[model samples]
Structure formats: structure tokens, C-alpha cells
Target: MRIIGIDPGTGILGFGVIDAKQGGYRLVTAGVIKTPAHTPLDERLAEIFDGLTEIIAETKPEVMSIEKLFFARNVTTAISVAHARGVAMLTGHKAGLVISEYTPLQIKQTLTGYGKADKKQIQEMVRLNLGLSQVPKPDDCADALAAAITHAATTRLGVV
Candidate 1:
């Protein structure tokens, strides 16, 4: 199956596409959709919706593995990210993709066998899981791939 994983954010939403099978996986593409820092929230959301729509149409993913929002201390930031996440989910739904969400802890534990694994450790596991020569550039990009890998592992285990 082709899975597209999302790490949603208003300023920079990361996405990774992978072809997953029972035996192995391969990276199809991985990148970030970055909006200008000072842009209006409405505009940023429109950009995110459009960007993810285009990506879904191009990648033809059957499933989307997106990060579930974790409550943060910054209420302003959290609300904006929640909007972005809604846009991302809407885009996936409109494209007829199955949406699956994983909490950050779930993703971390699935990839690294630890709920509180550091970013570096998670990145290393992502690199090794995909047999990449080096870690995927930018933390957000690797994180998106980690979401994808988490889905693959979860499905491999016969879970949702």
C-alpha cells in the first residue's frame, strides 16, 4: 500500500510518502510545505489545503498516517496547528484516502520501542528502517517518515 504521513503545522507541514508492504518499504517522497512566518492564518491554511491536495493527487496514497495533536502550553500555537491539522485531514478525506492518526508517543514507541525516545534516536531508527544512508534532512521531514513507518509497523502487527 502507498501511505502518506503528515506532520501538520501552520508554518511548516511535513509530508512523507512510502510504498509499504508486508516484507519491506521504500520512500516515495519526503518534504515540507512551508508557509511564510508572518502570513495570515487563513492564507496559511489555504496554502496547506492546496499543498496537501496537490500532494495527494500526485502521490496517489491509499492511506494517510497523520500525527495527532498533543496539547501544548502555547495556546495560540496549538490552535493554529489544530486548524492546519483539520485542513490536512479534510484534504485526505476529499481525496478518498483512509486517514489514520497516531499520537507522538505511539509513533515514538513504534519506531524506537520507547515512548520517550529523543528526536535523534527516532531519526536514527527511521534511517535504519528505510535503509537510508543518512537520516532524512530536517527534523520535521524525518518525523513525517516516522509517522509513515509507525503505520507500516502497526499494520504489520495486524493492528489498525
Candidate 2:
């Protein structure tokens, strides 16, 4: 199964594609969709939607795993991210892909066996899980990959 994971943000949305094969995972691509800070919020959202649509077309993923929104502070930032995330989800839905969302805690726990694992731990595990030489650059990209890995693990266990 080809899965695309998304760590959505207004300024920088991260995405990763992985193929689950023979009970293992292989990285296909990982990157960020960055919008200029000075750009208008509406335009940034449009950019996110368009970019995600293109990615869906290119990757041809069977499903998408996305990070669920959670914020204790910064309501403004959270709202913006939620908008971007909506666009990402919409793109996936339009492409006829099954979408699943996981909390950051769930992703961490699934990848490292600890819900409160640090960023370094998550990155290292993502790298190790995919057999990559080094962690994927830009922390958000690694997080997206983690989301994908979490879905793969959970689905395999019949939890999702």
C-alpha cells in the first residue's frame, strides 16, 4: 500500500510518501510545501490546496495519514494550520484516497514505543524504520513520515 502522510501548517506543510510492502516500509518521497510568510493567508491556503492536489496526482497514494490538530496556545496559528489541513484532506478526498488522522502522541508512541518521545527520538526511529542513512531534513517532514509509519503499524495491528 502506498500511503502519504501530512503534517499540515500554513507556512510550511510537510508531506511524505511511503510504500508498505511485505510488512516493511519504503520511503518514496518527502518534502515541504512552503509559503512565504508575507503572503496573504487566503493565498497561502490556495497554494497549499494546489500543491497538495499536485502531490496527490504525482504520488498516487492509496491512503493519507495526517496529524490531528492540537494546540494549548496560539489559537491564531492553530486556526491557520487547520485551514491548511482542511485543504490537504480535501485534496486527498478528491483523489479518492482513504484518509486517517493520528495525534502526535499516537505517532510518537507507535514509532518509538513512548508517547512523549522527543523529536530526536522520533526522527531517529523514522530513519531506522525506513532504513534511511539519516533522518529526513526539516523536522516537519520527519513528523509526516512518522504519521505514515504510525498508520501502517496501527492498520497492521487491526487498530484502524
Candidate 3:
């Protein structure tokens, strides 16, 4: 199965694609869609939508595994993230992909055997799990790949 994992944000939406098989997982591609810092929110969202839509088309992923929006201390940031998240889901749905949502805790636990694992720990696991020589660059990109890895593990174990 081909899976596209998304880490949504208005300014920097990260995306990773992986081919998951019974044998193992293979990284297809991973990167981020970055809008300028001062860009208007609506324009940034459009950029995200366009970029993700193109990615889905190019990669042709069968499923989408995305991190669910969560924020305890920053309502302002959370609201913008919510918009990005919504756009991501809509793109997946329109593309006819099987959409899956996973909490950050679930992703971290699936990758590192600890729900509260630090970003570095999870990124290291992502590299090890996929047999990469180095961790994926940019924290957002690694987080997106982690989401994909979590989905692969979950499905392989019959949990998804």
C-alpha cells in the first residue's frame, strides 16, 4: 500500500510518502510546503491545498494518515492549524484516499514504544525502521514520516 502522511500547518505543511508492504516499508518521498511567514492566512491555505493536491497526484497514495490537531496552550495557533488540517482531509477525501487520523501520542508510541517520546527519539526510530542512514531533515518532515510509519505498523498489526 502507498500511504501519504501529513503534518498540517498553515505556514509549513509537511508530507511524506511511503510504500508499505508485508516485508517492510520504503520511503517514497518526503518534504514540506512552506508558505512565506507574512503571507495572508487564506493564501497560505490555498498554497497548502494546491501543494498537497499535487503531491497526492504525483505519489498516488492509497491512504492518508494525518496527525490530529491538538493544542492545550495556544488557541491562536490551534485555529490556523485546524484550517490546514481541514484542507488536508478534504484533499484526501476528494482524491478518494482512505483517510486515517492518529493522535501525536499514538504516533509517538507506535514508533518509539513511548507515548511521550521526544521528537529526536521518534525521528531516530523513523530512520531505523525504514533503514535510512540518517534521520529525515526538518522536524516537520520527520514527524510526517513518523505518521506514515505509525500507520504502516498499525495496519500490519491489524490495528487499523
In candidate 2, where is summed lDDT lowest over 10 consecutive residues?
Answer: 49-58
Q: Whose lDDT is greatest here?
A: 2
lDDT of candidates 1 onward, in order: 0.93, 0.94, 0.93
lDDT of 1: 0.93
Kindly indicate the candidate among 2 and 3 with the higher lDDT.
2
For residues 1-160, could you state the per-residue lDDT of candidate 1 as single tens digits?
9999999899999999999987788999999999999888999999999999999999999999999999868888889899999999999999999999999999999998899999999999989988899999888899999999999999989998
Clashing pairs in 3: none
Give the alpha carbon lDDT tens digit for every residue of 1-160 in model 2: 9999999999999999999987699999999999999899989989998998898899899999999999999999999999999999998999999999999999988999999999999999999999999999999999999999999999988899
Instruction: Tell me the lDDT of candidate 2.
Output: 0.94
Over the full model, what C-alpha lDDT does candidate 3 score relative to the true structure? 0.93
Worst 10 residues of 3 by lDDT: 38-47
Q: Write the per-residue lDDT of candidate 3 for residues 1-160, one digit (tens) a residue.
A: 9999999888889999999998899999999999999988889989998999999999999999999987999999999999999999999999999999999999989998899899999999989988999999888999999999889999999998
Candidate 2 accuracy as TM-score: 0.98
What's the TM-score of each model vs. the native? 0.97, 0.98, 0.98
